[model samples]
Target: MAYQQPALPYADNALEPHISAKTIGFHYGKHHAAYVNNYNNLVAGTPFDSMSIEEVICATAGDAQKIGVFNNGAQAWNHSFYWNCLSANGGGKPSGELAAKIDGDFGSFDKFVEELKAAAATQFGSGWAWLVLDNGTLKVVKTGNAQTPLTSGQTPLLCVDVWEHAYYLDYQNRRPDYVAATIENLLNWTFAEENYQSAK
Candidate 1:
């Protein structure tokens, strides 16, 4: 089956001032849609054409000859997950088991925030910062370009896309500001909690 871009969990303007509707229009309607289109095109009539997105990502992850397939497939999957990582009512600290895991893994929720913010800010180029389960422990990880934890055996609970296109129009050169707003005002902890429980 061909890959299709998933609809946003909320309306285009739901994220409001934290993320502009204009940004969502371009980001989701254009950029993400392009990735899905590109992936479908790249995989059509090939062995990957019949595989799931995760299967394609893992299969093509380190093959230099398949970089296009990996990049597009991963980006398509990543953006789909990233949208669910935001919510109109998101942000602040998570609660319950996921919250307890954060404290246990990173010392405190504040420290986890500090680490996640640092990972997102210091990623250096287009990429993502993620909260993931690695060997049953929660860890903060950053991946460059279309790289994702799925290719590395980790279960991604949540992610922030730090690609320039993700925030360029909204915050211009202030990537840090964009990252902070996303972490503080837009992260969907409920989504993260669901992922955490499923992974466990």
Candidate 2:
């Protein structure tokens, strides 16, 4: 089956002020769509064609001969996950079990934010910052290029795309501002909580 780009959870303009519709138009409509198209084209007649995106990612990851497959498949999956990680009504501290886990694991929600922001800001190039479950503990991690936690045996609970196209049109070169705004005004805690619960 051909891989398809998933629909954005909200309308293109929904995340306005913090994230412009123009950015989503290019990032999701163009870049992410390109990855999905590339992945489908690359695997159309291969054994990987029948695999799910995650399966393709795992099968091709770190295999030099399958780098194209890995990069496109992983980026496709990553962008889909990234869109869901944002919300028009998101942001603020989480409540319930996820909140308790964050506090317990990071010492406090504030500290968790610090770690996540640091990870997102310090990622040296095109990559992602993630809040993942590693051995039942919540942790912040960053992956360069098309790398993802799925390849590292970790379950990603949330992610923020730090690739320039993700924020450049709106924030210019101020990546940290974009990262902070996303965390403060757009992160979908409900989605993270659901991911955390499902993993457990």
The Cα RMSD of model 1 versus the native structure comes to 0.6
TM-score for candidate 1: 0.99
* Model 2 lDDT per residue over 24-67, tens place: 99999999999999999999999988888899999998899999
Residues 1-200 of candidate 1 have per-residue lDDT tens digits of 99988889899999989999999999999999999999999999999989999999999999999999999999999999999999999999999999999999999999999999999999988999999999999999999999999988999999999999899998999999998999999999999999999999
Cα lDDT for residue 139, model 2? 93
Candidate models: Cα lDDT each: 0.95, 0.96
TM-score of each: 0.99, 0.99
Candidate 2 TM-score to native:
0.99
Looking at model 1, residue 91 earns an lDDT score of 92
- Candidate 2: C-alpha RMSD to true structure equals 0.5
